[model samples]
Target: MKKEKIQLKGITWGHTRGFVPMVATAQRYEELHPEIEIVWKKRTLQEFADKSVTDLAMEYDLMVIDHPWTGHAAAQKMVIPFDDFLPETFLEDQRENSVGESYASYNFEGKQWALPIDAATPVAASRPDILQELDVLLPRTFDDLLALAQKGRVGFSLLPIDVLMSFYMFCCSSGEVPCQNDEQVVREETGVRVLKLFKSLADHIDERFYAKNPFKVFEDMTQHDEIAYCPFAYGYSNYSRQGYARKLLHFHDLVALKAGDEPMTSTLGGAGLAVSSQSKHIDVAVDYARFVASPEIQETLYVENGGQPGHLRAWKNTQVNALTANYFVNTLPALERAYLRPRYDGHLHFQDHAGDVVVHYLKNGGDERAVLAELNTMYRESLAWEGVHG
Candidate 1:
């Protein structure tokens, strides 16, 4: 009699960084365990961010997820908690070495809903050769960045989602964290100040960039000499790798709001690995998840195959830093201080619409107070949803 074969299907966002490593790891895992085979698929980035975990859980054995979805996943039991499946020591190591709040972001209601496999936050990127040719120093302050934008040398992602994340960055940098209260996203005064600051910068850039995302901004930077610097974008290590693009990008921590202040806090963005509760082969899925997230694998195979690793060891690996032109070394501080977004069951509802409100205020120059009021209404409604749904 022949032995039975186990097959597991996984879904991740479509990107070289997002999709490639899973395939690499799956291939490696299959070689290590001949009886088990893993197949991976991908969806668009927007779909990855907005799609419900419950829907994906029903079809796939493994899922690459946004941390914010953990709250909903836990609430709905869409994915099994790793605490019950993975070893305690492994979980402790993940917590200690997490990039910023990456590990904690996936823990909701006292359950470990997922294991962080990748980590990122917005960081500054520049074309060093272009800057040298233009004789421009990298912008060190908010005003310097504004002046560069005024010269049409700075490119940034201004999509509603990016704008909203920047809104959080400015609010937090200015000593007021947004969405801390049930009734408001931030204090009225802080919201107004952030909006004004954001608009002043946005006013200087080309209007066409309003539709671009971070990936597009990076592509524009490397493909043309027009963009000398990008003030901030969710850092992608691929651009820093040699031969990955036409021009190599030099990445670093964000510029200060002013000359003397500390660098700003960016909103955390990364993908987590979770096993579906509906999977037929739970043990094999858990074992595969561990293999992918283990420190040795994360630092070696994962990063080598186009991954931005969640493990701190990978971030500190000298060879890994060399491979990406010190991208990990330079941006790790920003990641360490990045703001972790809310993970309540209903926070996604607020996240989905709040960006549009910020984008409107940035483009239309409305009463900042009205913007705050609208955001507050959303916040209150989100909390009410938790009450009814939680």
Candidate 2:
């Protein structure tokens, strides 16, 4: 007898880490339950970061989303809150085993908007062959990194959004964490130093860096020998594996900053799997999400296929360690202590525009005081935007 199969569509970022796990999980789930089939599509990483979940929800039954969208998803009611469909025990397990704030980042206004399936943040990457050739050692301090960048052996993503993230890192590195108060994003003195630090790096590196994203930087590293190291970029474990790229990258935690012995906290980034509010096949979508996020499946199948697992168990698994040359073990400290972004309802608008303000100050030498004032104004405005939009 021929089984009647129902097809479902999903959207994820167009990267090896973003696309493979979903397809692998869907294929396994279909083998177990022949009546369902899931087809996943992908958009560029930039599009995935820039596109609104509400707009994507209307077209697809499922979506892999950024954690920052939790507030927007809740305000717009674009995705199903997972509490009802997923068992309470399952949700609790996820929270207990989450890598840092990966689980909490998706829980907004006490509603679970999505299941985190991938966990990542900015970390250092280098070509060991290039490093050895240059007779340079891996950096362990911010001063060491700056020296390396000065030698033209360093490169990183400094695109608009990347610049904003780097500013956040600089703030934390200097002992002035941002978004700590309702009045302003950061203390004025700290904001000034952050800008100066960013500009100092920009001045030393090539202008081309300001236009590239992390993925592009990694792609360039693999194809050329111009840049030997990247001090910080979102870690893609796939690039560290054998035969994954033209050249394999070695990833580790970032250099320690002037503020402390610990490395500066990178902004948290990872995608969550969610069922759309408008989906007719809600039951199937939820089941598929659960299948993808399960610790056992995540540790074994998902990691094998190039996905970075959010589950703590997978991160600690010995087999997972062996495959990627201990990539997870090396970067876990960075992920567990990563900094989280603001998830307020109107935070998106502020983030969308704040990048340009920082980039302008970085490119054109200007009054950093004005930049801080502009950011503070944007922060206050975003809060008000939330009130009216709420």
- Candidate achieving the largest lDDT: 1
Cα lDDT of model 2 overall?
0.89
TM-score for candidate 1, please give it. 0.98
Error of 2 at 272 (Å): 0.5
Top TM-score model: 1
TM-score of each: 0.98, 0.97
Residue-level lDDT tens digits of model 1 in 62-154:
999999899899999989999998889999999999998999999988889999999999999999998899888988899989988988999
The positional error of residue 29 in candidate 2, measured at the CA in angstroms, is 1.2
By summed lDDT, the worst window of 10 consecutive residues in model 2 runs over 256-265
lDDT of each: 0.92, 0.89
Tell me how candidate 1 scores on lDDT: 0.92
